[model samples]
Every structure is written in structure tokens, then in C-alpha cells.
Target: MWAFLHRFASPPHFYRLSGRMAPWLGWACLGTMLGGLYGGLVAAPPDYQQGESYRIIFVHVPSAWMSLFIYVVMAGASAVALVWRMKLAEVVAVASAPVGASFTFLALVTGSLWGKPMWGTYWVWDARLTSELILLFLYFGVIGLHSAIEDRRTASRAAGLFAIIGVVNIPIIHFSVEWWSTLHQGPTVTKLSAPSIHLSMLVPLLLMAVAFKLFYVTVLLMRARCEVLERERNAGWVRALIAREGSE
Candidate 1:
């Protein structure tokens, strides 16, 4: 398994494989996303308390989940890059930053929209909200720090170190509601016991979550492949790949 991973992690091979896989991932993302949207918006019944406003959960909850989940992925990849000096891990870490930030921004916006009716306000410095806000800034810091330096290797190491250190906040974001008296609602879908959500609602939420994960991987592969080409522009394989493209 390790040998296979080491082989697959080669820049040229990963680029080729990811290019072939992207279309399939795109189709899957589209199908799952459509199903989730239809289920969330059309089929599922409204919440007794929140009504139509609750529909935003289909987007907000998934974005919020991805916001945290992607950071952990970045931090893990960063650790690998830092410890093993893996170029692909470094690329994955840097590539994930922007996508993670976008999701965090979406989560914050949707949460505010949902909060308006539920909390009688658009924003608050609650534990989860504040931690999530910090998470966005963390993503920004990684992207900015990486770009600030001209040397790609040096930049990735610096950014990877930053990502590893910033991982302390992930658990804080996940457990904020339980750790403090926050305005954000506690987890209903991920509790240890049976989910509090109805079957109708839970199914769509799960589908949306799966779609988000697929979307992230699809985008990450696309971004990472481009990053690889830029990093390997002078390599023989890259030149050969360019020749092939030109011939076609």
C-alpha cells in the first residue's frame, strides 16, 4: 500500500490520473448535488418552528461542516509535508486553503441569515461563530503567507507550519456549542444518539454533505493538478505533456 501510494504520489502520474478522474467526479457531484437540492427544497417538509427559513440548513450546515472538515484535512496534509517533505501534500495543503475559506464564508453568511429570525440578530460573538470566524482568518493567513514568499518550497513549508499550528481551533469550533452557552444550535444530525432530524430532512442533509465532500475533492484535484504543472514546468514529462496537448 505504501509503495502504491509513493508511486501514485508522483507528480506526473497524479496529474494524469486526476485529469482522467475529474470528469467522473464532476458528473457525480452534479447528480448528488441535484438530488440534495431537490430533497432539501422541494420534498422535505418545513420545520414547525423555523418553517421555510430552515431550508437554509441544507446549505449552511453542509458548508459549516465542510469549513471545519477541510481545515483538518489541510492541517493533516501540512503535517505530512512538514514531516516527510512531500510535495504533493504541500500542494494539497495550499490548494485547499481557498476552497476552505470560501466554504467558511458561505457558512458564516448562511448562519447570519438563519440567525436573524432565530436569534433576533444577524451576528453575535458566540463561541462557535467566533471560532469559525477565526477559522476563516486562518485560511487567509495560510494563503497570504504562502504567496508572500517567492520560493515555492520555502513558502509551502511556512504555510504548512502555520496550518499545523492552527489546528488547535478545529476541536474548539466543533465543540463550541457544548463548551459554552452559545446562540448556535447544538448538533442534531451528528449526535451520539439517533439524529433528531426527521428521515425526510436527514436524508437530504446527508446527501448534501456527501455532495460537498465530492465537490471539495473534485476541486482540490483540479487545483492541485494545476499547481503541479506550474511546479514542474521545466520537467521532461511536463514538456512531453505540452507536446501532446499541442499535437491534439
Candidate 2:
């Protein structure tokens, strides 16, 4: 088990694995996203109350879920890097930030657009909204900090510390609707009983969530490969890997 882990932990091994995995992940993500989009926008029935406005849930909900999920992943990676001193994990954490941030921004914007039509307002200080906005800021902070430092290791450590600390916000953002009386709606898909939303709406929502996750994995692998190459430039294996990659 340790041998397997050690082999995979080597930068060259990870780089080669990512190369093989990326295309498959990318194709799967594209297929899933296209199907989910069609299902959500065309097939899913409009809400009786919110009418067409609820259609935004297809994008908003999935992105929101991804924002929190990706952060947890980043934090977990950062924790591993810190504990095990794994440069690959740190690179992954850094690579994942921007993608997750873009998703978070999409969620915020879509949520605002959806809200304006239904709630008659584009912005609010509600707990869920506020916490989510803060999440976007957290992503920005990590990215910004990384860029500001010239030293790669220093930047990684700084961003890693911040990411680990900011993870506390994820749960707060998730449970904000329940913890306090807020304008945002409570849980629909998550409950002991059956989902509050109907199966038609639920199906598309789940599909989009899965699509977003797959997309993240595809992009993360791509970016992590680049990161590994840059970091391991001096290594003999990296030079050989580059030659092999170029020939292929």
C-alpha cells in the first residue's frame, strides 16, 4: 500500500497519470454538462410559484455546491501538503482555486439574477448570500496571495495557511439558512425525508452537480500537470516526460 502511494506520489507518475486521465474526464464532463443543461433548461418543468425564474437553479445550485466542495478539497489538499510536505498536493490546491472561484462567481451572479425576478431585488445581506459572497472573496484572497509572492514555496505556504483557515466558512455558508432566519431558501435535496423538490427538478440538479464535479476534475488534472512540469523542471524524469509528451 505504501509502495503504491509512494509511486503515485512521485511527480513523474502523477504527470503521466494526469495525461492519460484528462481527456477521458474532459469528454465525460462535456457529455454530462450538455445533457444536464438540456434536461434543466428544456425538459424540467418550471416552478408553479417562481415560474421561469426557478430555471436559474440549474446553474446557481450546482455552482454553489461546487464552490463549497472545491474549497473543502483545496483545504484537504493543503492539509496533506503541510503534513506530508507534498509539493504535488500544494500545486493541486493552487490550481483548483481559480476554477472553483469562477464557479463561485457564476453562482453569485446567477443567484442575483434569479433573485431580482422573484424577490424584486438583485442583492441582499442574507446569511446564505453574504457567506457565499465571502467565499468568492476567499478564493480571490488565495489567488491574490499566491501571485503577490515571488517565491513559489512561500506563496504556496501562505495560500495553504489561508485556505486551511478559510475552510471554516464552508459549513457556515451551507447551514446559514437553517441556523438563522434568512431570505434564502432552506435545504431541498438534503433531508431525512424525501426531497422537497420533485423528481424532475431533482434529477437535473443532480446531473448538473455531477457535471460540474467532473469538469473540475478534468481542469484540475490539466493544471496540475502543468504545475508539476514547472516545479520539476530540474528533475531528469521531468525532462524525459516532456520529451515523451511532445512526441505523442
How well is each residue in 33-110 modelled by candidate 1, as lDDT tens digits? 999999999999999898889999999999999999999999999999989999999999989999999999999999
Number of the top TM-score candidate: 1
Whole-model alpha-carbon lDDT for candidate 1: 0.95
lDDT of 2: 0.91
Candidate 2 regions with alpha-carbon error over 4 angstroms: 243-248
TM-score of predicted structure 2: 0.95
Clash number for candidate 2 = 0
Where model 1 places Cα greater than 4 Å from the true spot, the runs are none
TM-score for all models, in order of appearance: 0.98, 0.95
